[model samples]
Target chain A: MPGWYYDKKELRHSPSAQDGIDYKTEMRYRKEGARLIINTGSKMDLGYNTMATGVVYYHRFYMFHSFKQFPRYVTACCCLFLAGKVEETPKKCKDIIKTAKSLLTDQKFTTFGEDPKEEVMTLERILLQTIKFDLQVEHPYQYLLKYAKCLKGDKQKLQKMVQMAWTFVNDSLCTTLALQWEPEIIAVALMYLAGKLSKFEVVDWMGRNTKHCRWWDMFVEDVTMDLLEDICHQVLDLYSQSDAPIHPDSPPLHSNAKQQMPSLRPSNGQEKTLSPDRPPSVNAKGPPLSDVPQFPYQTFTGAPPPAAAYASVFPSSMAGPPGGPPPHLSGPPPHIAAPPPAVFSYVNHPPPFSTVVPPGAPPYFPANAPPPGQPPQHRPYYPPQ
Target chain B: MSFEKSHTYEALNRIGRGAYGTVYKAKDKKTGNDVALKRVCVPLSEDGIPMNTLREISLLRQLNTHDHPNIVRLLDVCHGQQMERELIMYLVFEHVEQDLSTYIERHSKGFSGVQIRSLSREILNGVDFLHSNRIVHRDLKPQNLLVTHDGHIKLADFGLAKTYDFEMKLTSVVVTLWYRAPEVLLGLTYATPVDIWSIGCIIVELYSLKPLFCGESDGDQLSKIFRVLGKPPESEWPEENISIKWNSFNVNSQISIDRICPNICETAYDLIMSMLTFNPKRRITALEALNHRFFLEEPINT
Candidate 1:
């Protein structure tokens, strides 16, 4: 008989919930691993795999076992041991105990030159105890791999997106939602989050004609504007690095937004910075929304530009030449009004993604809701970018 | 057991739980079919949910043809999630109010050989159809056999069933050990006769209103069977007769199958003996078992 504990429902926002997990821990895990793996061609590593297994196992163990009662490290160790068991090359019990000691000690466990086999034995006992001795919940990692399989052309970009998405999963573990979402959705959200961050060529694959996904628009807005960009900010703080991938010369990755949306890709080859039909202050540089002109555009960290400084970016649009209000913000442009209250202000910061309310749907994550750290699900943020 | 059923098939109560999957009673919105939906949830680690889902869909697309009256039909497959896990596959089964275990529980006084004859015949009929189609119901027990409110016995649980494709050689230790055939207990590879052994246990359950050979250990179970029909003979049970060898229980074992229940008629005894035979090759098929004098001679009315 198949041995699986199945819960198909979304657990986020369940009436009763636990103290949320911090998404940063997941970031630390991925950052440490990704720093070494990014240029390394995503080598298959037993370390990260085992680490992820431990994290997920620890995560699920808490689903039934309250975090209030159990030690998180114990839970983490349990997951690692369980993973070792499933991986089939289990270490001796004493090595597991030692690993646990090393994992918890001041001069904590470092995987460098130590006998990895011996270390695992010292760690196994505590891990087993944390697991309450049951190890049937091991899940297969094929979902992330299968999702990377593309139905369209230009597979390189999709592969790149997989890495970015995995980054999201790791970072998402820091958020309280992980405890709520199933592994599949968590994985999908990561892919969705990374796609939003990268604005990859596969964006077109997520639109109207995309089979089985009729809710593309909603998915985009909720995923992108809400979770993804926020996740990118949370994980990579890549708002500064956004322009590099946009450059067309990059191999495998198409820097042009048009590459992502063939429907909207400009055919005339005109630059968006010069387009007259663009928003007022069409060419406004640095922090597309800011109006401050104190520093040169290059010096600005998206420093908000003033209404007057914006008009200088595009001379033709500012002149109001042929029946058009200067594209720049002279006064309150009828579109976006004055800067209102900060949802949860962080100067260069975007709001926490959970609060993104799709047009018809309720907030993906309630802004007013107290932050519950990582559970399982982070939040659903569909990206249209 | 609570059901809003006809409206939304809300899964209000869980009647049965197991490692294999959970069985819930649901209602088909349009047709109002009171369906028992068994969801098989296999764990896929950090990966996405698409592949397993597609695999289940594709396989069911082929296997869904098992719509016989005696077979538990797969009504529908659900994937689009609601609030929870939308990745689950919902398999629909017609409402067979009670399974054999439940039926026997309610009918504790037990059935006479005449009544047992018809029920056993129906059970055999289901098994006969499955074997002929090359499907082996690997986990056949009273729990997998449903007795409808009308008292019809239909076989269920295709989750563990496998096709006898000549290319693939599978293990035999699948069905619950209590109902396991001797060949299976020894880890040897046998065919549908293993299912027959389960049917034998189920048949005895139906007759005596109690489990037959319900031992906790495999050794205890084999001994119980031997105490009844005598140990398997070495001549009949060649270690190579099947795929694997269980030296402890192999060759001249002379296990018996007598103490299971007493005072059974010769015809019923003969039918059970044929099914409980250690020599799987000699064990009668469901069709032959159906033609046995027990079923032919005694027609069940009540």
Candidate 2:
């Protein structure tokens, strides 16, 4: 059975389960850590492609290994570091380390940093092995620009809508949508949402207005309405919970420990520190908020963050729409149940060529239409009377 | 679960070696299927996994998703501890009977014109798939093309393959020297057209049993090309503003199809010439090459 099956079962466990912390709590911690790393990367002027790829890498890596085996923040930094190199927008290793360390230190968290270089470098190797060195990742950003160009509309409004869709792609990365859907599908769905929000009509690939065509038809033939709806819901879930506080264990950013992350490297062959700032109730099911210093980071400023400001870097909400949840978000995920394994099971037994639909095959071909220029596949015979 | 190399596969005799690693014939313990496992020893130091191996792994996985018939399949990936605490990563691929180079060697004189047409068609199909996916197989040559026992061809060895972005800059140093395109030899940034030139050279080799342009150095390579096809008109080098300094040589437009290979059909000759067109823009695309009369003829299918 896949790890996801175990994760689904674990999600149903009550808060009082017998453990110091449940998997849900651990997952939240890691997701937040990844989000912070992405924000820091963006602050460092990394391209959105690199940031998107890094978060996707972080998600895929965790599928094979749990948060307990590796420090989530450290892994997040390593993923960004590696993605920067893979995307050909290489960043100095020291810069990545410093930015990540500063973010964690501001948040009052700690992990091994005795040899920050060696620790990150070691984790980078492990990451390469975990994903089996498959580093090329496709992103929806490029497709958004392409689709926006193909859609015939007011140039200025389309530009604004494309920009909005671009943000939607960035925010969707915070969730598991990248891992679950094809980049094209994500791109189309986000464009759909952007159009709905902007009141502009999204067009098909041929630059025809999409008013009469099925919304899904505007996309490549492989995409289905169900696939787009599932992706839309996943993104919607992210927006719905945008106003929620950061993971409970995350320390407020105002903590004064500027050098809080623990140094993991051995010094004089002595024992390494496991975590920074040990609390009196270390064994408690959850950490107390009392020790966390009050901070003014926009996330914790107590003013309902402007939907645009929050969504600016990583929008959590899609507000100002005419009504409640768009008609698409109220349904269950697409019937395409669990996201397929990161490395497909089909690796061992690939699907045969006979089953491969040609690249542009219509979603639903006419039932009686024979394949173009070819005889009907069925065997012909004179009926016996 | 980790793909435990030792538990799943037991290695057989070593078959070949290259810059990255050694290739061994191995058996899948569970299915008893034979696989060609390329074992690359990746050191655990700061350099991490070599970028070339990473490129190969990612490209193979991406191509394997669609599983094109003419592209080799990557069956599995595994790693094991080697001596000196080094890590050996094994890329398991479907085993083939032989490669194009070996097939030609076994035949002594080269393949028949019909066999050349069929093989060229398969190569074009495989190249078409890669190009459609925005990938360029930078090092396409005869040795990299594998042949199954039943005479099917599959393009293999993607160490130099990369996904191309128009604005991206790439090193001109790719594809073997002999098969390298003129723009690449001239130190200009080249793209998918380079592969077409290399395929042209391979097609000639397939028909004549030897390399058409056997130049010892980059300079000599251009000379050989100019000697046979004459100088590429000034308009051909528009992207490259400066003119090429060619050796004082005579134009040889007289070298016709009959002179090159009298046995080759006219359509095959036409296709080869189009691929060898000096202008990158004019060079035949894999898709267009597939539709050439050379491939449409009945001789290619049988």
Candidate 3:
């Protein structure tokens, strides 16, 4: 099986970041994209496995290609379409597209382009290539249930714990933990979190106890407290952010300096509407751009005038290159004939790796290169400095 | 992001037409290796990629990771040119000189007793590997088994294969009818045993130099099987097979294995009969067949 895991540092400088998208904005895009897949899949009556697989595919796809290059919603739908087939619950691309159309607002749906069916079908090929055709994905849900069965606890409490962990696994799809750890480790960590939350302790696990034996050790050997706590915190972090009600009119509070330091402001009004909590009010009017305060450092092109920053970030047309003619289409659609070339120039001119990497950091790329014999294209696109 | 298919692989000649697409003998430009490229044309429909194509690719990709010697190697999978209405996918496999059918035909005097024993063991080893991995090669026949120049067998043609666990009622229209199992003919649910039944038919063909149960239709296929193994006991008849009546087949007595394959030893006859058992539950598995006395009685030539 192909190893899909990457460390924290690798994720910090993801392909989306290389394409000039800030890390926080890229994460927001992922959360919204995952939500889109889940909602559309549920609307189409697809099972959780299919939807989860789609989200994993969406996450893995962005690791190689930029979220800016391919619209997240279109890729989400294509992922779900491909996931349905992979999970043996095949759904027609038209049905998924139709469901997506109903779920997305008029402005957001426009990102799918003129012919949504053709757009998704073309991206389906790209999605397959990006994922290296490693279609089989193992999820934490099965491990959660299997471990629950082995733990001796009150029946109702165990059931509740399992249910909570299952939800955690679902929410974890919105994070990059799936790309950083195996499903088995995720399952154990979530179960540990659920146990603490539900106040259920596994005093007996039907296994002999060694000195200082942890419950997780029975399932996965050498699972350090730090690793388990880290996975739990990642899932817990989602809840911490989701606790605050995100009103359509209010700006997201970048309370932490760490968040504000790396993330660019939402490039356009369309992206501002991608808040998961306000999907139905996607077209709800927000404060005018003039009224919103400008942060000088929020511009990705460092120290530029705020007006020049906004001009460089905003595309003249949303349905241009990012959503424009698919590679297979023989002729460029008339609407895509004149694309804003400046928007994507940064894709080829990423900042130096040293600028992003802390000093004394271990070498990441050479050790983590894809196994030899994989097609050259499968290698992650590390932009030239 | 895939490399241009034409640039990566240079087609040497057309191999043959398979169930899903055309096969070609090709050479890999990067590695300078001979390869067989199976080109599957996926129509650009509203449904997107076909489920079978996806399943086949995913399953083969997973299975190839094990690098089992008895199974064909899937070196690479790349997309070809996309036409107006269809997308082409090329599955690059390591090229083998000939299939078992060609191998059997080339040796006009039929396989020696030892050769049959070795080939049967290799075939069982491949089937056992698949079954252990929860995969069933739904289409198993002489033509699907590739024989290297060194007399090794590699199971191929996974177009109809599926990863089966418990009771998976797959499409009944699988496997060549001549090698199909009785449960499948009777429209009953099947699992890995179906492959075992195909292997049995193949074992008989190795001796007879022809298909053991050559039936033109589903019913005829069952009749031919019953004619040899005898109509299964009424108690053994599956309740799911309501269409096929118990009294339909006129077969009253089972034919002796010695009469059908006179040259085979007692151990070989026993193993083949065990595989050909009417009831799938009663039929021997690939793993069990590998451990049978037939293989232990003689030393196979390396």
Assess chain B of each prediction and give its TM-score: 0.78, 0.81, 0.87
Model 2 Cα lDDT, one tens digit per residue, A143-262: 776666567655544544565566567667767666566788788988765554444544334545535354445556666544564565455444223223533332223332211111
What is the DockQ (computed on Cα atoms) for candidate 2? 0.22
Candidate 2 C-alpha lDDT tens digits along B187-265 = 7778899999999988888777777888887777887888777777654554555355543435565455346666677
Candidate 2 vs candidate 3: the TM-score winner is 3
lDDT for A156 (candidate 3): 49
Which CAPRI tier for candidate 1? incorrect
Residues B1-302, candidate 1, lDDT per residue (tens digit)?
32321234556456665435667876667666677877544222222222323333334434546566677666554432321222334555676788888888888776876768878888888888878866667778888788877888878775343222111232232335788888777667778888888888888777667777766677767776776666655566564545433345422445343444564676787888788778888888988998888877745434
Cα error, residue A24 of model 3, in Å, equals 2.4
The predicted structure with the larger lDDT, 2 or 3, is 3
Alpha-carbon deviation at B205 in model 1, angstroms: 5.3
- Who wins the lDDT comparison? 3
Query: How do these models rank on lDDT, best leading?
Result: 3, 2, 1
- Candidate 2 clash pair list: A111-A262, A112-A264, A113-A263, A113-A264, A114-A263, A114-A264, A311-A315
lDDT of 3 at A274: 16
